[model samples]
Target: MTETTAPAVGHQHDGPHGYASDKGAYLKRMRRIEGQVRGIARMIDEDVYCIDILTQVSAVTKALQAVSIGLVEDHLGHCVVDAARASEAEGAAKVKEAADAIGRLVRS
Candidate 1:
């Protein structure tokens, strides 16, 4: 299945994103998760136990969720805050965008 991502916020700040400082760490975690996913595929090809594959799937899911949460936090701490400081309307729009993202996470 294909994955869909949220669109970028309309705020036009030229500075680095909130996650910039932690970009390396994020990349590392994602790479590890990518390895886990590959392992899962290998397991399936080898006909591993269903529960074992499911366990890996769960781990991958949690890893992705952790990343998602971190990104959301960064966005709030930086993007939303900056927008809020810029103007009330910009802040409200950011807040709504964040709420929509959170809602998608919760539903998923």
Candidate 2:
């Protein structure tokens, strides 16, 4: 099945089978970011202006962060919630794991 038909990784919401509704948007964002990354690479290869390259780098970084936030939100809304509904231990594990991942992201 395609992205649309696939069940949301962590949810059973009314939003197009979980993240399915968001999938299109996510892919579009990713593609835009991907192109930005390629442009940065090209700029570096061509020795483009330093400030211009830096600006592109910053944009790429922000785009990536946005994607990360979206995934984290989805995971919490769907996966963590499901685990919490399952059992306290599972919920605890999920929360701890998410926290650790967030910590890592923040440090990076």
TM-score of each: 0.87, 0.79
Q: What lDDT does each candidate get? A: 0.89, 0.79
Name the lDDT of candidate 1: 0.89
In angstroms, the error of model 2 at 79 is 0.2
Clash count (model 2, backbone only): 0
Q: Candidate 1: which pairs clash?
A: none
lDDT of 1 at 73: 96
Question: Tens digit of lDDT per residue, candidate 1, span 59-96?
Answer: 99999999999999999999889989988988898899
How well is each residue in 1-108 modelled by candidate 2, as lDDT tens digits? 355553435523333333555898999999999899999999999999999999999989988998888888887887778778978977887789889888987877
